[model samples]
Target: MDLIAPVVLTRPAGRNAPLAAALRAAGLAVVEAPALKIERLAVAPPVLQVGDLCVFVSRQAVDACFDGRCAATPWPDGVRAAAVGAATAQALRLHVPADAILAPAEGAPPDSESLLAVIEAVGLVPGRAHIMRAQQGRDWLARQLQARGWSVYCHALYRRSPAIWDRDTCAILAGPGRCTLLLTSLEAVDAVADSLRRQAMDWPATLKLVTLHERIARRLQCIYADRPADALTVRLSAPDEAALFQAILASARSA
Candidate 1:
């Protein structure tokens, strides 16, 4: 492994292992700095079974839904499925049959706007749709659906918290640890930086950074530039780990 080429995995803990393996294959050391904490929400079986449109906001939400606490019964037949991105949409497809899945262009961020476009096509009426995602997130779709006379019920399927950095981990990131940081959310990036500062270490720019969207990419550039005008970073142009890993492999091969 490239001791100087450590990959900084800032995804959730449930997601870091696969990414770690991917970097190891590229002969790079893996320094996991998971900045997001995920917790599943509990819902009564009978109460949640009355929605026409069922949406999965993130892959984690779908996983938590089937963690042996919910009914094994198939989703309601009349229910329609929606996902935030191509990858998440694909994950939803693995279990439930999604009737209407929307995504951004292959090289763009799969955001709330893209999901809203598909929801609009369904002609959703108020109270007919149900959104399932993290404990808290953007309410744009819910508000839009309500404005369109669609009743939207958002059930918090999970909660995202920040990962607490230990002293050892803080020391590594402050140094030239050569870890590639995969940032999927802005909150996670901010958390990682805050954790480091609490440890009294400099935020070094020696590690490779991979992001899933241009907005997040720009946000990182601004934050990193504030400290060291030139920090090497790259945007993966997609909201997925596989795509980001492929981009990393290709970049390293070319370098």
Candidate 2:
């Protein structure tokens, strides 16, 4: 693995500003080829009951939900909001108070499991809850909440369409350097792999991957198993941008 390879940013355009800036600050070449184009859905917001819980799977969820259907509607007085991680929690704070938001316990992993643990700790055992996210987001959290006897209302706030493979995106994937791809979502990883195939390039052979979870890594392995060159994949301990940069630097130094 070569250190300081060109890093491909696959996050949605609206959400990649901070991470892209940080990557450039670390002296790595960045290719801004978004894998998914987020489109807000035209849906009616559900009324919240007292003691109801609302979960935002990602920052995009918060933005899509509030900026679309719930633009003028205030959050119900006794309803509480929850986010999977600090970034999403920060996004929630833009529309709701810090005290009204619930998140994974500080120092705990920022994931569905941790968020579920926190919800259970706060005595949110049963009642009604809402899960706001992309159209085809993972359903594990919603299923868990339902298992706990909560009436889970899944609101598809946005739709994630595969991004078009423009000339610059094609060049980045087919470039000569040992490029690295930053994949934070499984859907984005699949879109990128499909994009490479559509561009007629041998994908993942000379490319390294920085994925947020082992599930995404497993998916990549399935995609690149037949390829000859083994790609280096680094999985971070956390999903935040700080941990992502640290993992990138550590991988670079070790290489």
Candidate 3:
């Protein structure tokens, strides 16, 4: 397969750079058009009484929460950290001790549901849990914890919003040949759709979309419902860069 389609990396700006560089090293032309702009909220972590497990929802959340002075603060003893995926776990582990970090079990899907199951099996009695993530992110996990009588707090460490595109971004999306979009979030799916609509570019019917989860793919399916049957919507089992790049290469070869 020729695999000449320009791959669009729709992760937030700083986060997209490394992935774009990696993709370029792999010989694929990359369009660095971020669908979301991540702005860290100027807030500090509230003092915990004890036994509160801080849950980081994404790597961005980790950066916002602990990349700076937050890491300098004395980490309270007896508090644990939880991450929904390996990437988030790695980020959390940078500040918290590895033994204090909880993540989805090996071989299980690296997602909220799987992490929740592991938390259940670990028998963490109803207590306080804080979910650190972007503003306006999903509350399903928090609700699940709450159902079990855990007092859940959602700390919006960063703000995520649709990226304001320039003329170059419009040109790239409207450029020649088939394009594959690597979208990692549901908000990103909507952002791309909205950007395309606003730009009034004729999106290629044969475009391929790679999403991190099935729910994002379902949203894309709705957005691109008018497309022809051959258009592809690929969903990876995990929401990480490695899985995304692998899916991209596989789909490109198959296409």
Q: Best TM-score goes to which candidate? A: 3
C-alpha RMSD values across all candidates? 3.0, 2.5, 2.1
lDDT winner, 1 or 2: 2
Point out the worst 10-residue segment of candidate 3 by lDDT: 231-240
| Worst-scoring 10-residue span by lDDT in model 1 | 43-52
Q: Please state the error at residue 177 of candidate 3 in Å.
A: 2.5
In the range 1-255, model 3's lDDT, one tens digit per residue, is: 536768888888877787777778888888888888888888886566578988888999888887545546866888888998877887787788888788986545667998898788888767889898888987889999999999999988889989867656866754666677787878887787677778776555666777666777777677568877666556464556676677776654555
> By TM-score, is 1 or 2 better?
2
How do the candidates rank by lDDT, highest first? 2, 3, 1
Worst 10 residues of 2 by lDDT: 229-238
TM-scores, each model vs. reference: 0.84, 0.87, 0.90
| Tens-place lDDT digits, model 1, residues 107-223 | 545877777776676565545667777776778878877777876778777788888898788776645434556778878877888888888766665555677777777777776
lDDT of each prediction vs. the true structure?
0.68, 0.78, 0.77
Quote the positional error of residue 244 for candidate 2 in Å: 2.6
Model 2: runs farther than 4 Å from truth?
A: 1-4, 69-74, 226-230, 252-254
